[model samples]
Target: MKDRPAFGDPSRLTTGAKLFLILSAALLPLALIAIFATLQTSRVADEEARARLRVAADESARSIAIELIGDMVALRVALNALGADAADAPSCARVQGVFAQQAVDGTRFAVLDRSGRVLCGANFALPVALPSDQPIAAAVVPGKGLILAISGKRNGPTARAFFPQPFLATLGTPTSRSSGFSSAIVVRDQELVLDTIDNAGPLDRMETTSADIGIGDLALRASVRSAPVTSSLIVAMLLPLLMWAAAAGIGWFVVDRLLIRPLRQLRASVAAYTPGELIDPGQVRALPAQEIRELGDTFRAISRTVALHEAGLAEGLVRQTKLTREVHHRVKNNLQVISSLINFHARAAPSADAIAAYASIQRRVDALAVVHRNHFAEMEENRGLNLRAVIGELSSNIRATAPEGASSVSIALDVDPFLVTQDVAVAVAFLVTESMELAMSCDPSAQIRVAIKPSEIEKRAVLRVVSRAFVESEELRMLISSRYGRVMEGLSRQLRSPLHHDPLVGAYEIAVAVLGRD
Candidate 1:
């Protein structure tokens, strides 16, 4: 399976995501604080605006009350003056003149008797009931567009004044537009005598601040539309948002430049690296963040050390292979020398038994030489020798070096090509040589056949040498057993399996199992 690329792997998050998460973690508290500050500032601003509106309304109410009181005092003086004169045309004319001089332009004065009847005065058509104990009392008549104020000394003739809608409305006008508020004069909490705006809508139901006018049970109420949103208030509300945005932008820039970019570059460089290649120390040092720069430097050092170790390992492997090949070459040459010496001794022997023993020794030496030659030949490939090739060459050498009278003996091979380690090849060669020697001792003219195959049960390489020869005499059997029995046993042990001999199938069969190696 192909390996996944690190950069786009779904399981691993990017540096950008990590930096964004960090920025979010840092800014979350700041955002919450900003929101809280904004709400609190708005609340304070609203309260201040409401307080200012209430103060303005209170001042206007007091001024209006003072004006009403002065008008009442002047009406009382005119009523006292009119009390001495008769309720006649000349007296009423004189009293009207006195009231006009003491009241505002839109105010009308009148005189009323104890029966609540208008006796004589200007605008005296309506009868007004005056409270005996109270010095002043006011009534709002919306249908007539007038506010009636009744005032007199207790138990004395009462005086009445009619305030026009224009006069009452003027009292609330000064601060209404400038302060963004609606003003109203209410009498006894029931009648709206004058208002700067209509007070019949939902705005009337909103909470308002009131001040007692201190004249005739009248009150002044001011209802604000809303707290004005001044430039300072807007700034207070938006500054935190602006600051939060700026902080986020700045944080992203700083993290990207100092941390995210450097880490991304380091990851890319590490991913692109291969064994034995050195990373540039200058590249690692160029990182902006100090900690990441140090980490990059450490990684560079580790990669450099790994490259050096790998180079040393490669050089050691080459030297070891060369030394192994040289050793195998020398061993093959020494074995050849031993085989030549044995051949020389066999040729010089006087008796047939001595010559046969020497020849047998020469064959064994030749088998060992063949193993070294095969091993030396395969040293460059760094693999085991081919067992089939080694056994073929060994069988050929044995047939060629056979004794003169044993020329008729034939060796046939049914060997399959299999690769085995050096030690296994040597053991198999020796086992084959011992089997051939035993067959030759039994009968010099026997037909020797060597077959190699994999075992069915253990899956090991099995070398079977079968010789169609007979040991007709008990003396030859004893000689063969005594001479090669121990040698075969040792070769079997080297192969890690016992040597099996079966003579009931009309052939001397010796089988050795060879184990495989890495």
Candidate 2:
């Protein structure tokens, strides 16, 4: 059995041979398309040539007709002169003398009676019969000339102009004759050629087109002829297609060397780029085009600069994060120290009112310290303070330091995973502490609920504080009717939103902006 060719295997063919086959396949269809387009163009050019030939033929026929019509003008003038003088005497002799004087070349003019018998003319022998009831008529006489007859009125004498061969031949202009178009006077039924401009080519080998033009009773046939389509004409048309294919191949080869190959190498280099590593320009430095080599060099310089700048920025960020953590740690320690100093002073105070004041001051300070600790904890990711962690820690610290009567107050937290700025967290902590303390003061067994829910607005959350003591206790209302109301209002203004109070639901809601999810 014969072995089949391994067409699918790349290893069987050399790279150069594969490329040659690919290029041939690509260019073959382009050559075919070019040939078909050229042939269509040739067909359109042929149709346009034929249309031009028809126009030339028509113009030639019109030129002959115009000349014939001009001659009639002179004939009418002579006939009118003959009629105006006929009443004085037998003016036939004088009319004939004037006709001979005015005549040009072999042109003849005559006056005919009602029976078509010549009354006065240079040539009186040729007597013709006038058609009945016809006012004007024309006819071409073979070997003689074209005859035109006109009359003034019915049964009146007729005026005739005889245009001979020499005069009629000269009517076909030299401009028309030289353009390969030929004009002839034809009698359609008789199939006769009375007069014609010389045809340039033989009748059989040429393509011919004809148009018939009528001048009175005479008909002119205008004809144009050209050589038929042949092998030489086709060869002449195909030369351009061959040249176009050669040009396209040359252009593709030039672009592949100058642009396409270099771009592919550059793309590979870019695809292999690493974040902190500089790209080497050596890969593209030997490219054929100066502009491409320069572009690669510029990219190398820019990448190196970017890599260096990024490294510097990373080092600076590490140092900045350490410094920020230390600052928050010191602030938190300072707040705790202040809280301890207040606690020590509260134990030594003689008045109960003064001790209560010291405890209130200590709670506010602890809330601030809790916010700073949480903010520092979130520094590694830089996602702002977690509201859930802050609220949970604050609720624990508040219950731990609850006043003597309010030691049994239960606090519940329903906080979402919302992250907020340090400033917003501070205000939120103060608002929660103030609400919890007011609820405890009204009823020591008060049940306090704090919820943080996502708001309809993007990157925003609603903080709702609820307590049954807020709804039923007149003492809680009186507490809010004093400085506590103003304090809540100031916290709301600090958070940049209004605090909404719903007495029926015993809940206070305020919207706060938050950082987006990790």
Residue-wise C-alpha lDDT for candidate 2, range 344-420, written one tens digit per residue: 99999999888888988889999999998898788888778888899999999999889888888899889998888
User: How many clashing pairs per prediction, in order?
Assistant: 0, 0
What is the lDDT of every predicted structure here? 0.72, 0.74
What alpha-carbon RMSD in Å does predicted model 2 have with respect to the real structure? 17.9
Q: For model 1, name the residue pairs that clash.
A: none
Best by TM-score: 1
TM-score of each: 0.66, 0.53
Per-residue alpha-carbon lDDT of candidate 1 for residues 317-430, written as tens digits (9 for 90 to 100): 999988888888888888888888888887888999898778877888899899889888888775678887898899889888787777777988888777787888888888
**Where is model 1 more than 4 Å wrong at Cα?**
1-48, 66-164, 174-179, 186-208, 214-218, 224-227, 230-235, 238-256, 259-275, 289-320, 402-416, 439-481, 498-518
lDDT of candidate 1 vs native?
A: 0.72
What shift in Å separates residue 232 of candidate 1 from its native position after superposition? Answer: 5.9
